[model samples]
Target: MTSTTVRPDLDLTHARWQSGTQGMGDVEIAFIEGYIAMRNGGTPEVPAVIFTPGEWNAFVLGARDGRFDLT
Candidate 1:
């Protein structure tokens, strides 16, 4: 079975990052080594925030549920 666990030494040097559909210079995300890596397109030199699949799912659900809505 495919593992969803990210390796401690995960390498993202060759990650093919994809930007949001809105346009360029937005947040970029890369799925690599069983982890999700996110970084700002405007500042790629900065370290990315890594998330596990479960964490990503939770964040997505929260967004869809408007848990982060300002209202």
Candidate 2:
């Protein structure tokens, strides 16, 4: 949920994807044109979800604040 507009014209063909140190099942992320692209590491064939800088920050903040905790 961001107030900024997303850049759909950005190309991710050469994007170098990164993942956490948790080994096999971790998700992948790529930084491209000031936006964050996320995708499943286990299934790279699936298209990625793009997020604006503000949306990425908000997601990180929410994760750090335990808003995503299921317990």
Per-model CA lDDT versus the true structure = 0.85, 0.87
What lDDT score goes with residue 26 in model 2? Answer: 61
TM-score result, candidate 2: 0.79
Question: For candidate 2, lDDT tens digit of each residue in 1-71?
Answer: 76667468768789999998867666999999888999997887888989988899999999999999899
Report per-prediction Cα RMSD to one decimal. Answer: 5.2, 2.8
Highest TM-score: give the candidate number: 2
Across residues 1-71, which tens digit of lDDT does each residue of candidate 1 receive? 88675446667789999988879556899999888888998889888888888888998899899999897
Clashes of each: 0, 0
* Candidate 2: worst-modelled 10 consecutive residues by lDDT: 1-10
> Model 2, clash count?
0
For each candidate in turn, the TM-score is: 0.76, 0.79
Candidate 2 wrong stretches, greater than 4 Å: 1-6
